[model samples]
Target chain A: MNESEKTRRKTRWFMLGAFVVAGAAFALIAATSMSKNLVYYWTPVDLYRAGNKAYGATIRLGGMVTPGSIKKLGGTAVEFDVHDATQHVHVKTSSVPPQMFRANIGVVVEGTMLRDGYFQSSRLMVSHNNEYKAPAKGHPVDQKTLRKMMESTEGIKD
Target chain B: MKTAWIFVVLGVAFLVAGSYLGLFVAPAEEYMGNVQRIMYVHVPTAWNWMLAVLYAFGAAIAFLFTANAKWDARLEAGLEVSTLLAFLLCCQGSIWAKPTWGVWWDWDPRLTSVAVLLFASIGIIALRGFVDDPHRRAVWSAVATIIASVDLPIVYYSVKWWNSLHQQQSSPQTVSSQFHLPLRLNAFGVLFLMIGFIMLRTRVANMNRARETALPPMTEHAGEIA
Candidate 1:
């Protein structure tokens, strides 16, 4: 190859090497710090594990709303137990829950754990699963059936 | 060029049929009810958006290695189409989020990573417009595209790797068989549309590049007047 062609080939290799190095560095950084920094919300188990550290700091706690635990304290204020398998946190929220909010549905509430016990949430949001099921045979699609379906958390895990 | 128009026609036909099935024929979801209909469009757009980004990444790599102007043209087409799909994906997600997630937007890892890549692609497209030198523009944009595309894996795996509000991806195994027909149809529809758009966009990019490389209009008359 001529001198110019040789130089051009060397430049291409250098560019390739730089890109590979940069890519590796990016992957390394993401792998190391992503888990720590990218958590959208903490589960009920995470709250239990935190112990005293979990108190007083505003945080988002996500889990299923326990069946039969939904209690309406008054207008726009509701209380429920957020459960994650073995662990559960009592969450009392003043904010109005979404239309889709119901028992045994996934929820993420943002607030602080009070000293007296129970999570005091200022914001409440529902998190739905990926599954989309049609109504079973002979069952009509109506408000009552939809409510019942929302209340049943069968085959779903936190 | 004619073949590109054929793909566009096929894409539109598929989309119409798929949408009819999704909107009228499919059953309402047990929990979400009719709102779940959005999934037929949203999921398909999301799946194709990822493919568009991948196309851009591949084109970028090919251009860098071969130093081929054709690849650069394809790269530009891929970037623009990816941006369009990403924008649509976000809008559809936002609409679905309101009733279900109780929020229009969230800073969760999955959503955030997608937004990051969308903005990165836009920035690269803007970079192409500012640079006058075709060679420098191609090389710089190609490198930028590859760099930005590192976020693709992160976007895909965000739900699995992090505590995201967004649920895990739904597949044939996860989704009910009854819902499969519309989903599959829409997926293919969007794929065809994306491919068609990319091909047409590539031609436009090629034409633009040609105009850029063409010699400046002869200035002999102006020189004589001077």
Candidate 2:
């Protein structure tokens, strides 16, 4: 082969080696740091696990809104119990919840754990699941009845 | 080119059918009601956007190995199409988020990773434009694309690995059977449209490259003088 061809071949090999090395380094960094850094919200279980650290510090706590636990305490203030499988946290928020907020739906509330034992949230956001279920046959589709139907589906896993 | 047109026609037909089913025929969701219908377009766009990124990554690898201009053309096409779809995905997600999540956007892992890759692809495309030499542009962009594509797996697994506000992926197993037809239809619709866009874009890139390599009249005169 000519000198130019030899140099071209060498360059290709160099490029390949660089890519492999860089990729490996990236993988190492990402694998170590991703889990700790990428968490968008903590669960009620996570909050409990944190214990003393959980109180007074602002953090986002995500869980399902417990059925029959949502209460409108006059005006925009509302209270609900956010629960995972084994643990639950009472949440009080002054912010208006999203229209989609309903019983048994996933939610992420951002605020601090109060000394009084309830989560005081300034912002409340709903976290909808991936499952999309059509209303049952002959079920009323109005907003009021639809909400009631959703409430009734609580604790019933599909 | 003809094949691309055929794909376009098929894509449009599927989209029309899918949208009809999603809007009028499908039953309202139990919780979100009519707002949930946004998934018909949003999810499909997201799925197809990932496919477009994969296509670009493959093209980038092939070009580096073979140094073929055709692969470069295909890579450009894939990058542009991926960007378009990514933009669409974000817009649709935002519209869906406003009513459902109470926020138009959030810094969740899944959403953040997607936004990162979108901006990365755009930067790579910009890199292609600044470099004047065709071969250098191709090589640099190919390398950039490969690097950017490392994020693809991260984007896919972000929801699974992290406490994301975004939900897990939906599939036939997770979704109700009644919602299947429209979802599948739109998925195929977006897939075909993406394919069609890439094919046409590839032709355009090839033509541009050809023009760039073509000898100018001034160059011919200079050669004679030399």
TM-score of every candidate: 0.89, 0.87
lDDT of each residue in A9-82, candidate 2, tens digit only? 65466458647864985686488656576457778787898989999888998878888999999999999998
In the range B143-174, model 2's lDDT, one tens digit per residue, is 88887887888888877767677887777866
User: Residue B3, candidate 2: how far off, in angstroms?
Assistant: 1.4
Error of 2 at B205 (Å): 0.6
Q: Model 2 off-target regions past 4 Å?
A: A2-11, A14-18, A33-37, A138-158, B215-226
DockQ of each: 0.43, 0.41
For each candidate, give the TM-score of chain B: 0.95, 0.95
Docking class of 2: acceptable
Q: Give the clashing pairs for model 2.
A: none
How much is the TM-score of the A chain of model 2?
Answer: 0.74
TM-score of 1: 0.89
Residue pair clashes in candidate 1: none
lDDT of 1 by residue, A39-141 (tens): 5788888888899999999898888898899999999999999987678899999988888798877888999999988999998988876667787777545
